[model samples]
Each structure stands twice: as C-alpha cells, then as structure tokens.
Target chain A: MLSVMETSRTHDDREREAALQQLQDIERAQAATWLDHPATPWWWAPYFAVWSGALVLSVGYLPGWGSALGNLALVAASGFLIGYHRRHRGTWPTGDIPRELHRPLWMLLVGAGVVMAAATAIGFLVSVWVSAVVTDVLAGLLVWRYERDYARAAERARRRLP
Target chain B: MSAPPEAGHEAAPAPLADLDPVLTAPKRLAFMAVLASSASTDFSFLRRHLGVSDSDLSKQASALESAGYLTVTKDGRGRGGTTTFKITKEGRRAFERHRDTLRALLG
Candidate 1:
C-alpha cells in the first residue's frame, strides 16, 4: 500500500490536504464495494420466491391441518438448515447491524405479527383462500414494502449522524 | 486552549488531532473499514481485496491486534487452518472517528 498518508507533524497544508483527499477517495471506493456487495447470492432471490409461493399455495390448496403441518415443517427445516449451513461454513457472517438501525425493523416485525394475527383470526371465521390472500399476498407485499422503506430510513439516520 | 467546536461532523473540518493514528495507515484502515461493515472477515478476503502480500497483511494485522483494534483467530489446525479477524468495540469507535474526522477535513 501507498504511504501517502504517513506524513509527519512538519507537513504543510498542501500535503495534509492531499492526504485528506486520498482518504476521501479510499472511503468512497470502500463504500461502493460495501453497498454493492450482497449478503446472499443471486440464487437466494429465486429461493425466496419459490418457497414463499409454495407456502402460500399450500395454505390455499391443502386442508387446514395439512397447511399447518407444511408451514411448521417449512419453518423448522429452514431453521435447521440455516443453522447447519452456518455451523459447517464456519465463516458465515454474523449479520450484525447497529442497534439503532434495527428500530424500524423491529417495528416492521410487530406490524407483520399483527397482520398475521389478523389473518389467523380471519381464518377462524372465513375460508382458507380468504385467509391465504391476507397472509400470503398482503403479507408478502408488506415485507417488501417495509424492507425498502426501513432500509432507506436507516441510511438516512446513518447519514444524519455526527 | 480553546474548547473544540461541538457540532456538524460534515460542515466543520475536524482537527488532525481527532484522527487515530492506529487506523490511519492505508492497509489497516482498509481492513478496519471492511470489518466495520461485516460481522467478521477472513484474512484471505482482506488480502485479496487489498491485493497485499501475506506478510504485508500480517504486519498490519499484528499492529492492529496489538493495539486492541482487531482480533485475529486461528480457526483450524496447521495448513488447513483459516484466520478470522473481527473488530473490537474500541476499534469500531476509532474507525468511525477516523472516518468522520477525515470527512470533516475533506469539507
């Protein structure tokens, strides 16, 4: 690496300015790489689409207990697989984000929970297809919406910091 | 001495005194930047990303580790082993301060 920033205390304004400029360039390059880098691979998108679709389809086509069992199996299997994969990989990311950025995500979870609760309540009083529309289509849309909105909010908050 | 100005990390140019020399080095700074973004990063990832030699990366990592800025862990045995690096809380704080200080200077 360049020792361009290793100037001494005797350095003048011009040299200091150059170092600062270089630092800015470095920061910009790093930021670009950081933002563009995906935590998951491209295949993850299709995985999500297929899995969610299957969950929704199951809720609509299967008997109530069958749907419940399928959903339960999916959740349990997903949890187990993720844990197993990470454990074996050893270098899997901890996926930590600052607690402040988590505020909106937590709220989003609460909102999703409320929607899910409403869907289950509706299921008790209505047909599986009706509940599936709420739980599947609307809930999926809500997640996507919150993901975009909350991510923007988090970026804003980070920028606003001193 | 007069007290330092209190507000605006963006508008006011920060003094060089505020910058941590530990993270000011190019390689170490880059390593810390990556660490700050990720939960943990492998030594190889950092090496490949920075395009630095193993010894060169090791020297910088050693400095940062000694300074309590990053932790270096050996994940396995012998040649099969992988080295992992994670930033300490203090290291993260210093990295953030260094970034803000640089930005302030840029302005």
Candidate 2:
C-alpha cells in the first residue's frame, strides 16, 4: 500500500543509481583503449613549424620572374609533405589520390600561389600585391571560422555526457 | 478418470540483465567514449560535443565528479570561464573492472 509519490521517488532513485553504474562501465571500456598512449603535445611541432615557415616565405616574397618558380617549388614541397604525413598515419579517407587531396584551404592557397606566379611572369607587381592582400584576408577569415567550428564541436562532445 | 499431470512452464528471461546498469545509459557511455579517445578534455568541450544544455551537463558531470571518476578544474578569467576535466587513477581502475565484469556477464 505505497503512495504514488513514494513509488515515483523510489523509481527515480533507482534510475539514477543505475545510470551511474552504467557510466562506470563505459569509462572502463574506454580506458582499455585510451590509456595506452602517453599524451605528447610536441609530437608534430617540427613538422608544423617547417610547413609554416615555407608558407610564410612563399607569401612574403613578392612578384618577380624568379619568384614564380620558387613559389611553385614551395607548393610542390608542401603537397608532398602533407601526402606523406597522411600516408604514414594511415588516416587518409578512402578515395583516389587526387580526390583525397581535396582540402578547401590548401586548394585556396595553391590558387593564390598560381595567381601570384602569373602576375610575376607578366611583370605586374601591382597585381601580385593586390593578390597577396586578398589571400591574406581570406586566409585570416578561414582560420577564424575554423576555430569557431572547432570550439562548437568540442562543446557538443561535452554535452553528450551525463 | 482424472487427467494426467501437466508439464512445467519455465519463466521468461530477464531483459538482458539490465545491460550492466552501469554501462547502458547513453550520455554516460558517450562521456566515457570521449574520455577514452582524448588525453583530457574540458567541460565546455564536452558540453558542446554532447549538445546538452549547461544545467544538464553540470548535473551529469557532478555525478561522475563525485564518484572519483573525473577531476574538474576551473580556470581562465571571469569572462572566459574555462573548466577542464581529466579522468583520475581510480576512475581508470573502476572502468577496467567494469569492462571485465561486462565481458564475463556477456559470456
């Protein structure tokens, strides 16, 4: 002869207890997969620095006859390193090499490089300057947008947990 | 003449024994999954990834935090409000035990 309120209260308590227990079980399963590797923040620091330096050099050096060839070389080197990293990690999405290479940011950068090279070949330093300015603005915007998206994704992950 | 004795009927099986009660809830499982994948994550990150409201996350996080399974810390300036979380040693051990128990039960 229990009252309805008492019965509901008992049910709620049991539910929370059960949920907590399940949480523990999941944590254990995940630990088996997660704890093997020690955290390393600097694992890819050298690679990132090298790539960043090359990008800065390619962008900062202005439009000139020789600069186009140098820029092309930079692009080739960057592409090779990116491909090598992806292959070594075995993390490449399933697709042909060309299709797998389709990163929007990378493509935009390459396009800018090509335009700068064209302006240099035609002896239009002014055009090259304009292109550089446009590319810089676009790159900044893209970076800001990506950071926002990453933050949002991280927040969503947190909310999924009890 | 009287009828012959009737055969016995077996009772129905329980629903998968409540799925270990501790490992069956969705949000808790998701939390464990995220923690298992990342070295450490923060409260904001988890909340955004899980798509739960702030209050809801706080409540669930408190339960795990109290159980010694997670460590939570508040940092950053007043406006920024950053809180970080990491799994503790006891938390890892508990998780391992739970996994073994589930495997045994399933078998």
Candidate number achieving the greatest TM-score relative to the actual structure:
1
A13-117: candidate 2 lDDT, tens digit per residue:
564565556545454334322222222223243444344444444555645755677678878877877665433322222211222123543654665565446
Every candidate's chain B TM-score: 0.85, 0.67
| Candidate RMSDs in order | 9.0, 13.5
User: Compared with the real two-chain complex, what DockQ does model 1 have?
Assistant: 0.19
- True C-alpha contacts between chains kept, each model in order: 0.23, 0.12
Model 1, A7-98: lDDT tens digits are 42225456467667657545532442233232333343344434554565576667889989989977986797676444333334343444
State candidate 2's DockQ. Answer: 0.08
Per-residue alpha-carbon lDDT of candidate 1 for residues B1-107, written as tens digits (9 for 90 to 100): 97675442222346778888887677778778777766666766677667799999999999999999998878688877879888899998998888777776655
Model 2: TM-score for chain B: 0.67
Q: Which number leads on DockQ?
A: 1
| Model 1, runs deviating above 4 Å | A1-13, A29-43, A57-73, A76-162, B1-15, B78-81
DockQ of each: 0.19, 0.08
What is the Å distance of residue A141 in model 2 from its true position? Answer: 20
